[model samples]
Target: MLYAIAAVILSYLLGSVSFSIMAAKLVKGIDIRQHGSGNAGATNTLRVLGKGPGIIVFLLDIGKGIAAVLLGAALSGQSDWVPVLCGLAAIVGHNWPIWYRFKGGKGVATTVGVMATLAFIPALIAGIITILVIAITRYVSLGSLVFAVLTPIILVIMEASLPILLVSLILGIFSFIRHRTNIVKLWQGQENKLGAKKGQ
Candidate 1:
């Protein structure tokens, strides 16, 4: 129990390290959350800082999620549920990073990392579908939503562990909640595309 608690706390802290915000400050002398779409995420990073910095932030955020799950597994002696819980904790922290005054990204990239680690085949399939959606529609938010909504169904079909399935469900709900504004904009045909200029 003590180990699990420590793992959760450590994972949260790891996720709280927003690479987008740090990269923006370092490269552009500005807060990423105040620019582009005012979102501390890869899409906004791409808009505000260009491809290099955006990709860096995306990879770093994914690394945070992967690290959290691995760390939880290690600290919890490879317990079945601890890693899943820690992964969820990391996603939550990504969405509301403590270091960033509880303001942070949408957790799509982090969710990708967590789900990939938890269930590789299902995640890979879902990811392929998501990329296809983005390629066809150029709507990153829609791709993200599709990934979030489909991952759990894939997991259930693959007969994943209860804890993992539950975490995926919660993560899906969190994704939808975080993307509420994007959903509205998409419905109104006002959402930005993948390569649109900043402040679009």
Candidate 2:
């Protein structure tokens, strides 16, 4: 019980780091959430800062997810469900941070991170598909949405554990829910493209 609680806390804190926010502050002394698209993720970073900073933030955000899940796995060495809960907590933290006034990114990068850690093959497959979708469509939100919705499907196809599959399904649904605004923008054809150059 103690291990589970500790793992959840640790994972949440790890996810709450918010690399985009920190990177924006470090690179420009600004809050990324105040900029283009009003989002604090790689796509917005690319729009406001440039490709370099955006890529850095993306990698770092993904790293947070991976680190949180791995930490959970390490802490819950004896139990599988504990790590699943820990990984889910990390995703929750990324989406609704306790330290960021409950506002944070869409959690796509972090979700990719957690999924990758929990089920490497399925995650990698899903990531490849996501990249392809983004590259072909030029819509980051679309790619992320599809990826989020497909994670649990990939898990089932790959024959992952039932608990992991169930939690991943919940995570996927939540990720899509958080993208509700983007979904509307997408339907209205007002959604931003993946690449629009460094700045306006």
Top candidate when judged by lDDT against the true structure = 1
TM-score of each prediction: 0.97, 0.94
Which 10 residues in a row give candidate 2 its minimum summed lDDT? 191-200
Which residue ranges in model 1 land beyond 4 Å of their true spot? none
Model 1: how far is 74 from its true place, Å?
0.3
lDDT of 1 at 180: 93
User: How displaced is residue 59 in candidate 2, in Å?
Assistant: 1.0
Which segments of model 2 are wrong by more than 4 Å? 197-200
RMSD values, in order shown = 1.1, 2.0
> What C-alpha lDDT values do all the predictions have?
0.91, 0.82
Clashes of 1: 0
Q: Could you give candidate 1's per-residue lDDT for residues 1-200 as a string of tens digits?
A: 89999999999988888998999999999998888888898889988999999899889889888999998899888588999989998998999999989999999899999999989999999999999999999999999999998999999899999989999999999999999999999999998898987532
